[model samples]
Target: MKRESKLEFRLTYDDSKEIEAIVCIIPGGAEDMNSYIYIDDYLTRNYKVAVININYHCIGNRPHLGSSFYLDDIDKFILDTSLKAINLKCINVYDINSYENLNNTFIKIDQEIQKLKLNQQLHQNYKLKTHVSFLPFKNEYQN
Candidate 1:
């Protein structure tokens, strides 16, 4: 019997930002192999996005697959490559088992990214204000 594989994925991002990150989880089998193409195409047209592919072995008593040994390294490589390709800091990834719980996780990650972007904007604004405030003091001391 051909082994059956199931995969679940969630795409999330900071709604306020034009750039978005996506995480995908693939459990067992070679489902990731196929899904990635679709994702790549989808993101190419929209906001810049990166995808992390998590590969896991879910079959009973099966030996670890050759690809599993370097899962982390591969994930990092893909993420970096995607970052360059999309020119966006967002990244998304998933593990096979987490597919079932993706809904909640997706929402949580989206909120976190939004918060981070907001904080970064605020920091930039504060720095601008501080620089402007210091300009007059520097000029007075120079004279």
Candidate 2:
């Protein structure tokens, strides 16, 4: 962690493997970096990527000061240009569990679809509809 820069983060990586990707976990609006330790652990162990639990700006007072003292904390830090990865998974790093849940539902739906010999196109439609409907409800039920 660099103290001089306003942006602060916790990095988790498996040194045994050659890490080529970075998984930056951004906490929720009122939440801090600790909220996503489970996520960081999962990603690093499963995906073999570097996990960065960023302490970004928060709305109210917080112990870690929400990454730093500045309001625009994230933009202050610069990413290494030499970095390479399959994709940069940034933004909304909070609700990763919701995605996992949705995936489980999708798997079940796919199994049902196969068993019933239903049209693939119709199955896709149902999945899209379910995902869109589920999006608005994810935050409502969260603590």
Candidate 3:
């Protein structure tokens, strides 16, 4: 997230809101171009969430021509460093470019991830109602 860093990302957030989690967008390249500026602005202005567009370069000056294999590394790095969850279920899986559902999807993802973080921050006194069964918490119950 540093200015001189190779981690190319654009972040946006509302002043009244706290950054609960990060939404790392690994965009699909239909063309080889640096179009993340507009995409970042649009997502941030609308969602009021901290939206980041990770930039990757093709081998050449090709538009949208990088392999998913290479991109996966970047994706994993972002997931490992920027996110927190008590269980894998805390992450929201959604299609990034579905304009009709984009805003709602981000909003829902923000809420879900935030809940996971909150639960963890509150000493993670998780319960059956939350239904997260993978943890080693002593309080976990069985029905």
Candidate 4:
């Protein structure tokens, strides 16, 4: 039996407050420890950075089947991590699979942020009110 190990991950932040995180999933082997080391150094140099990793098992060697099936899981991980980074006030979140559909995701996120900002501004500037108005009914009863 092969040994189980942690995956390697790296996180870096720039002066502009953008956070970049990456996880290297080595196929058919355990996690790479250097990923964590690099992430640690990055975090030390830059504030508000997060890095994490997941292990992928070789086919016929572990409980899980293969890496292809884990694509959804990986995507969710990236989104969740990105959201967390955003909550931490990071300008951006970079991922390994960011090249895939990232532009669309970023656009959607930007729209939501804009909507929130607009709502906040409206709330601060205007008061909300509810009113009911009804027109007179025809003279059917009189007829």
Query: Which candidate has the highest lDDT of all?
Result: 2
Candidate 4 residues lying further than 4 Å off, grouped into runs, are: 1-100, 121-143
What lDDT is reached at residue 113 by model 3? 60
What are the per-residue Cα lDDT tens digits for candidate 4 across 1-143? Answer: 43344333333344455555543333334333343566555564666444443333222222232122122344545555655643423333333233344555556666655665576733333322212111112111110
Residue 101 displacement (Å), model 2? 46
What TM-score does candidate 4 reach?
A: 0.21
TM-score of each: 0.22, 0.37, 0.30, 0.21
- Estimate, for each residue in 1-143, the C-alpha lDDT of model 3 and write its tens digit: 21222344555566676666667776555432256667666666676568766553322223234222121234434443444443445444323333334346446655766676676743454432221112111212222
Native-referenced Cα lDDT, model 3: 0.44
Rank the models by lDDT, top first.
2, 3, 4, 1
Lowest-sum lDDT 10-residue window in model 3: 131-140
The candidate, 1 or 3, that scores higher on TM-score is 3
Those runs of model 3 whose alpha carbons end farther than 4 Å from true positions after fitting are 1-5, 31-33, 57-143
- Residue 64 of model 1 has an lDDT of 31
Model 2 superposed RMSD (Cα): 19.6
TM-score of 3: 0.30
Which digits, one per residue and each the tens of the lDDT, describe model 2 over residues 11-35?
Answer: 9988887898988788876677877
- Model 2, residue 118: displacement in angstroms? 69
The weakest ten consecutive residues by lDDT in model 1 span 128-137
lDDT of 1: 0.39
**Candidate 3: which pairs clash?**
31-63, 31-64, 32-63, 32-64
Model 1, 24-95: lDDT tens digits are: 545445353344556555654565665445533332222232211112334445544543453334544334
